[model samples]
Target: MNIQQILKISADKLRQKNIPSTALDAEVLLLEALSKCADEIPPAPFLKGGVLANDAPRNDNKRLDKNWLYINNNYELNKKEEELFNNFINQRLKHKPVAYILNRKEFYGYDFYVDENVLIPRPETELIVEEVLKILNNDRREQACLFPTIIDIGTGSGCIIISILNELAKNKKDKIIHNAYANDISSEAISTAKINAKKYNLNKKIKFIRNDFEKFLNKKSIYNSNEIIITANLPYVKNDAYKTLSEDIRKYEPKIALTAGRDGLVCIESLVKSVLKIKKKYKQKIYIFIEADPDQMSRIMAISREKLANVNLEIIKDLSGKKRIIKLLYCHPELVEGWKAR
Candidate 1:
């Protein structure tokens, strides 16, 4: 059959299966199938706005309008390629996420290896990386010039830490010598993270430590440096809410990476307490950046107050105008007083 016919039929099948982005999904699957079969796609027609009849209605019959039929009739797929494309379409119908099907996701302009073993990186988490980079570039700490240890807690897929390191490597002005660390509780996650790190040639630069938060806490001697910058996008989805997530996420992504405790504040709270303990033991200032649901702000703030009285805190909101990242500047109480008095 022609390209149009296959896409229409596959999209119709997906529509029937209640796929949200039927047309887009059909296009991606078909293109992926074509690339997989080593087909040299023509650039003349398909490149010049010949893929989809963007103006066509969503209904089945309307999907095969004149604009689409012309392109479809011109482009045809062979038997084996057609079968492969159909298989991909079927998988989409099964509620599998596109990223998992592709086995790669673009995060911070870099591709990261992902699968069922680790949580798929989301757009929202990009804000965490951006904020951390900003802090590193402009941090006014007395030890700022010294190379800081950049630690990513629960480093799923190693996207955040690797992306940060990649950006730092590109920054000529700073010329910083930061040590990178990827800490995760899951062996599977650490394995996947290391793969991505090596893909970007950052494996040697980053130290991958497979341990839960508690174990990492006990082995604090590794972080002997005075300037420490810690960032974590740990499991913050509530257990009950996790059950209600989209089918693709609930079925495919790692549950351990998506969920925490009842209120979704378990990991974040534990992280806050751990950072406090680390600060007390090392007697050094620590900069902590955490990503959490907006709803958990008050509870997180309450913990900060109860545990770290007189701490300097900043809440950063994402593009959606919801609070997403929490930044804490841990200074001595006397330092805090001096800054406030100034």
Candidate 2:
């Protein structure tokens, strides 16, 4: 059958199975399957329409561009292409995420490898990276410090920390003498993050630690007046709420990275408590950015009010206009007067 016919059949099958975004998922999976087959069979028939397996094209420019797969969807699929496409369709019927089937996901203009071990990077997470850039740029203009430290808590897939490093390296105004840390309790998550760091040639720039928040804080590290930024996208989905999530998420994605406690705020609360201890011991102000469920904002703030005595808190809304991120400026109580919550 032709390419268009195959896509239609696969999409219909997915729709019958109640898969969300069936059309888009069908297209992505088809392209991925075609790309994978192109490697084993050189100058493959389906590849003539410009779908090379490798990331970059050959130096001689003989290899067809990868984008051709999406551009020329009307091209015919050979017998081998039909076999591979069917297998992918079967996987999707089982509620597997397309990113996992493809082993790749794009975030903040950078692509990273993903699997069942880590949570697939979402678009909303980009906001955390954007806010970090704005804060760092502002600090460069106002402060005389030459080095800044970045710590990413529960850094699954290492998307947040690595994206930040790539952006910071581009700024010519500032010398990039930054110490970055990414810590995760799951060793599988840490391993996946290390793979992504190596993919971007950022292995040395980031220190990937396989430990939780409390353990990381217990280490013998100095926290002086130099700028420190903490970014956490820890688990915030409640246990009961996790059960209500779609099969595509609950079945395929790691549960350790999704559900918190009964209230969905246990991991976040623990991280905040650790930050309070760090602040008291070091006596240096630190800026924190976190991603949480929009509905949990009031309870999170209440936790901060009781545990974090001196903090300036602001809640940021996601693109959907829902409360998504919590920005906290942890410093002395007296300094809180000058800054207004945004």
Candidate 3:
């Protein structure tokens, strides 16, 4: 059968089986099948097929012409094709995410290894990195000539924090993070983050700390508060939300990484209190940005303003205009007083 025929057959099968990305899924599966089998696919006229007549409508048939797909001597299915197709179907049937199946997730123009141990890096989280880099790059912070010291709280898989370091490395500016740090409550997560760091040669620039970030902050050693940028991608999915997750997600993914308690404010609340206490003792205002569930924006903002009364806080929206991030400046009470007195 030709490319168009296979796509129609596969997409219909996927739709019948309730796959979400039916068309896209079909394309991926078929393209991989062709590549694995060394099938010869030519840029011939849209090969007419039984699917084109009735079962598949002609008009919106995706217009997938010869130019769209690549087929060569590899077009014919082989033993490898069967294995690849079986693996993809089995994983998808289990609702495992594509990134996990591929063992890589793209973020900030780089790919990081991700598995069930850590939360999958989301495209939305890149906004936090973008904002952090912007603040560190062109602001007064840029004048110090010191490499930007960034600490990522709950740095699962080290994606967001490492991406910033990687981007800066290209400019010979990564030396600033000579003091960079990343902490996560899970040892597995810390290990995974370290792997990514080592793979990118960012091991020297990033310090992986396997500890509860909240507890670390509550410690007596508050000198670390001197970091200019503190970013976190904390667990914010609510307990009720957990009930709504697919069976595969609930059964296979890490529970600790997904659930954040009843109101989904456990880690966030602890973080707020710790940062507040640190700001009071250190008296140094530091910039902080964190990613959270859009639904939790009100709760997050309330915690921010209440705990950090002296600071200015704003909710950052994602590309879709949802409240996807929280940005805060942890200012000392005196800073607020000075501003008000002015």
C-alpha local distance difference test of each model = 0.79, 0.81, 0.72
Q: Which candidate would rank higher by TM-score, 2 or 3?
A: 2
lDDT of 3 by residue, 139-219 (tens): 455464434447799888899888998877776666555467888989998999998999999887677788889776665
lDDT of 2 by residue, 162-210 (tens): 8988887777423544578899999999999999999988898788888
Number of backbone collisions per candidate: 1, 0, 14
Clashing pairs in 1: 4-72
What is candidate 2's CA lDDT for residue 276? 81
Question: Relative to the unseen true structure, what is the C-alpha lDDT of residue 187 in candidate 1, on a scale of 0 to 100?
Answer: 97
- Taking all chains together, each candidate's TM-score versus the true structure is 0.86, 0.87, 0.81
Which residue pairs show collisions in model 2? none
Task: Please list the residue runs of candidate 3 whose C-alpha ends up more than 4 Å from where it truly belongs after superposition.
Answer: 1-9, 29-74, 145-148, 219-225, 333-342
Poorly placed runs, candidate 1 (over 4 Å): 39-73, 139-144, 173-175, 333-342
Error of 3 at 6 (Å): 4.8
Leading candidate by lDDT: 2
**Superposed model 2: Cα runs more than 4 Å off:** 38-74, 139-143, 222-225, 333-342
